[model samples]
Target: MYDQLVNLISTLGFPIAVSIYSLVSLSTKLDELIKSVQEVKEDISAVIKYQKEK
Candidate 1:
């Protein structure tokens, strides 16, 4: 019974750790993507404003 408990804890622990790591990595990537998108939006707005002056 003790061996089974240890095995279960070890197995569950790895996946939970991996899941948390993945979530953190994904969150970081999403923040970078959002910043890039915002930069693109600003660039497009600038272009539009310049064209209107013509």
Candidate 2:
């Protein structure tokens, strides 16, 4: 019984740890992507405004 408990914890622990790590990493990457997209949007808006001035 003790051995089975240990095995179950070990089996479950690794995937949980990996999932947490992946979520954190993806969250950081998603923030960066959102910032980049916002910057691109601002640049496009600037270009459009400049063309409209002509």
Top candidate, metric TM-score = 2
lDDT per model vs. reference = 0.85, 0.85
TM accuracy, model 2: 0.77
For residue 14, model 1's alpha carbon misses the true position, in angstroms, by 1.3
Off by over 4 Å in 2: 1-12
Model 2, 6-52: lDDT tens per residue?
A: 67558888677568668989999999999999999999999999999
Which lDDT tens digits does candidate 1 get at residues 1-54? 668646755878867756866898999999999999999999999999999999
Model 2, residue 4: displacement in angstroms? 24
Q: Candidate 2: global Cα-lDDT?
A: 0.85
